[model samples]
Target: MDRDKEYRDACNQWLADCMLIYHNQVEKIRKKRLAAATEALTLCIKKQKKCVNETIKETIDFDTSYANKPSSVQMNVPKKVLEDLSFHSYIRMSATQLENLVSLTGPEMQKNNCFKKSIGVAQGLLLTLKFLAAGDSIYTVSCQYSIDCETIENIISTACKAIWNQLVLNVMPSDLSKNRWLKMAQEFEEKWDFPHCIGAIDAVHIVMQPSSNESPSKQKSNERNSIVLLAICDANFIFTFVDMGTYGCNGEIFRASQIGCAFENNDMNLPKPSPLNENDTENFPYVLVGDEAFPLKTYLLRPYPQKDCIEVSRLNFNCRLIRAQKTIETCLGILSSRWQIFSKTINMDVDKTMKIVQACVCLHNWLRLSDLSGNSCVRYMTTELVDQKVGDVFVAGSCRKSSERSGAFKDISCVGSNVGSRKAIQIRDSYLHYFNSNETLTRG
Candidate 1:
């Protein structure tokens, strides 16, 4: 009985200790909760004070007069001053052409606000054009236009986007009809003396400055430091199609491969195959002539490799094909010369750079088709008709030989071996025969 009594007393003592420990834990939790609540309240009060101080400061410093004030600086190029300015010097367009562009893109580019006045559409258009034509940095352009650098950037972006969206449909159609392709083919035959040709395809390296955050390895690579602009131009210097923003590190062959995917996928509405000569019964598809950098496809013709020069016929075929391909090179030269922006390394965001280039192409097409066509800027464009009149055959051949030295020519033999079919070979041979027999080859 005494042992049982001692056990009961011990159990009671253990229970008492457990209750005391539980009470101590509850008190500690209460203190923690109080500290957390106090900290949160203090933070909330601090944020509210900051907000109130900011609001009060903004209200006190707000100047109503500044909102009403006009820009102290204005565009100095007035009508009389513009008259004195050369058409090519002022935005690389005739004044009449500039007016026409303004008419098309004005409504879309105009911005307005109730408190602060926005830039006028006319001023904005001029600013954008001068920026592109001058190839000036945003800060330099902003100073000339009497606007902030940020404002100039906004204007340029908006104007370029507007120009591309508004004019690309009319200038460069994605879905060309059968008649349109036929028209291009006829022009190629008549002007370039090349049959069954619709366009000349090529790519150019648009120089760009490497970003600060780019890796040292990437910056060191030439291709990584530039952009590739792939385009197809017609017998005229107008761009028929453009695919921009490809990485510079990629070769022209890579860009062409992307188009090949579209062609194979039946997404590209290519012209239907027809006769090489009007009298011939066997049909041949219209083809685009590109340099050796591109792979040989049934629809795209590249020259024979340097080692493949076994016969005069092979050499003649390369010459004629290069004659057709020269259109794209001339178009690129004219574009770069006119814009001046393309001649140097473009230091801007990739997207902005693309839009600017796209805008230039649209303007080129517009200028080619516009009534204001007497501008001297277009005289730089190479003309097949002029060369034909002078009986110049060696010019294209010489150009091809010179171009081969640029190291851009790829060994496309392996790639072409699989893709080029027997039928395409026959079509190329037929053209070679036509070129050899039609006219006596003469030196340029």
Candidate 2:
């Protein structure tokens, strides 16, 4: 009788175990179904929202957001707000400077405007200045200026065009006379102690975000596209010449440029080679200092490679060239710091980007030249940018940090690796000898 009871108890326990396993399997299946349904519902809602957004975007045309004109934007900014330095100095312009910019660009913006309620001249200038001062999008700018994205676009285009047109001549003249070049050389001599150096040449890469239509490879964050800005700056940290809107290798772009051709052909009306001292017989060209990316030529001087700098003369020559080269980099640093647009990648098309860059360059030169007292530019150019003699060593300025934040002030990676001519080597040696022998030049 006891054995029979034990068998019954075992059967009952076995049946309970099977029932618990079945319940667990059913519960798992039910939970999975619920999760799948929730996922499907969320996807449907996302699709609906996407459809609605697309329809709304279709209703609103980007180019015709204002009135009827493609280039006219209705502005709501007050005149007082536009003129107030405290209000608008986010773009780094003084009140006097802002007024001057408005005056320079006002006429072009006011010409042939049929719209009764169009953007005012000061308003347009402020809007454009805001755009150039940072990497904000048109829509983002629209929110701040109380204007539509499309109208903001037109205002930026019109304002940039006017700025470049009005200030190009006074700031960066396309054609400089021989006397002007000589004056530049003299300034270089006095300030940099670099005799016969009229300007410093270098290329700064302007970072660009590739449009969706461009190759997918370029759209990656790591593989960004860039347009090269090849510039020559004088001793006063002003751009003497600017060639922008070029893509590809820096050396190739420079070689294909008009100024580059002038350098090669000796047709830029640059000062003729002359002896620096009365006793010195070797004539030295008024040259532009450049980095290793640029090829050494009679008209341009690049430093000797580090691998070949076994002699003290080569190192000394490199230091002088580097000292002069700081002019261009410092100019770029100030431009980027003030304009602020160069701190981030430009999202516009190449043509539009070119116009913006040109406009900024002109503005940079205008402010630099107008501040005759040098007080107005003091904040932008502190002692951090100037070279100093630290004991026996000649130390470079620590202002490279200022340029590190700029998108357009960084050096190009793709070098030309160009083999310079024999004449170029002889000229470099001559300059090296001249610097090493002169006690005045050698003492830090």
Candidate 3:
């Protein structure tokens, strides 16, 4: 009976151990199942959060926000602000003129494409003007205009091309009429007192960076990559002709040679040779005065180099040439001061920079015309007044006495002897005699 009791106890213990192992296995399975469910739920939650964020971003109206913001150009710029001098200083145009430009350029700049959301014509022009007047970077303008960098770049380039295509013909009349040339000549004689002088010729350097792809052989020794702006300005500081994009390595004389082809080919329609004085029988060609950098042509007059010039007559010719050449110097000075873009190096690629420069020249003419039309009180400023001051100093030193004047004419025989042709020398001597005879005339 005792043996039977021990066997029964052992069996009971074995059954209890099996039951405990089963419970532990069930717990392990439950934990694994719970962990898988939790991971699935977490992924769903993340997907829902991403979807909600995207929907919110899509619903936000960038244009509407920009319009309502006081920092924006549309709402921030008031109607009265357009007339203010500060506003004009920023855009370089009066309210009326700006309106006209917007009206003129608006249709072309406006987008009709499917992108439906694009910068407007007026806004684009405003952006371009801001860039030109302030010399601001594209990124800066993009931030101010509330546009993307790509959009700002597109707007500026398109607006500049539009301005050039639309208004350049009207502003820069290439085929000027004979009457117009005569009027220019008359103005030169009246203002600068240089007879038969149509304009003053000069050149300025516009600095730029060479392209990365530029061949090593093409690179200049000085490594200066620049565009030469060869221009001729009338007495009133109007650019009559402009040729740009010549390499800076080429000297001014070589650059002038490039522009003189039109005149040589008779395509320029330069005025016919006429007498310097009304009573004089000897005829003189309508001439463009330049510095010693230019070679003396029948139509182009350069000063006798001071190194070779010993006589007072040569000095007098040089003084007169300097007086006329001041117009171009002053024209370029005013251009740089007003635009301010030219004062610093242009950061654009070569092709775009060329277009912008051409546009600036056109706009300069437009503003000058506006100034003459009673639109703005500020006249197109020039350095001619400073030139006049220098002339005052020169007259005080050189033209004070009759003996000094007599001594100048006495040496006239030696003038232009080494430099110019006989005919050219004779023409210069006639002018020298004319200048000497009219000693009472204003030496402007």
Which candidate ranks first by lDDT, i.e. highest?
2
| Location of the lowest summed lDDT over 10 successive residues in candidate 2 | 56-65
Worst 10 residues of 1 by lDDT: 59-68
Tens-place lDDT digits, model 1, residues 1-444: 999999999999999999999999999999999999999977974453343432232211111222223544444443322233454476766555666677787666654331125465666677777777767877788677577776676778888888998899989988887788899999998877788898998776665778789899978876666556677899976899887655423333343456656655766676788776656676778888888767667777888877987988789888888988988876766666556566466777677778888898887787776623565333323353223334644344223332231322122212223246786677676666666764524411
* Candidate No. with top TM-score: 2
Give candidate 1 regions above 4 Å deviation.
Answer: 1-73, 78-85, 112-118, 248-258, 371-419, 437-444
Which TM-score value belongs to model 3?
0.70
Question: How many times do residue backbones clash in model 1?
Answer: 1
- As a whole number from 0 to 100, the lDDT of residue 340 in candidate 3 is 59
Residue-level lDDT tens digits of model 3 in 1-444: 899899999999999999999999999999999999999977874453342432232221112312222222331222224324666777777666777786676666654221125554555576688788777877777667567777666667777877887787888777788788889999998888888888898765566646567776554532245566678888887788887766533443342445667765777777788877668787788888877666566667777767967987677777887888878766766666566566566766667777778878888888888766767654544333233446447422111121121210111111111355677667676676677665524453
Query: How far off is residue 28 in model 3, in Å?
Result: 48
Model 3 Cα displacement at 95 (Å)?
0.7
lDDT of 2 at 270: 82
- lDDT-based ranking, best first? 2, 1, 3
The true-versus-predicted C-alpha distance at residue 52 of model 2, in Å, is 46
lDDT agreement of model 2 with the native: 0.73
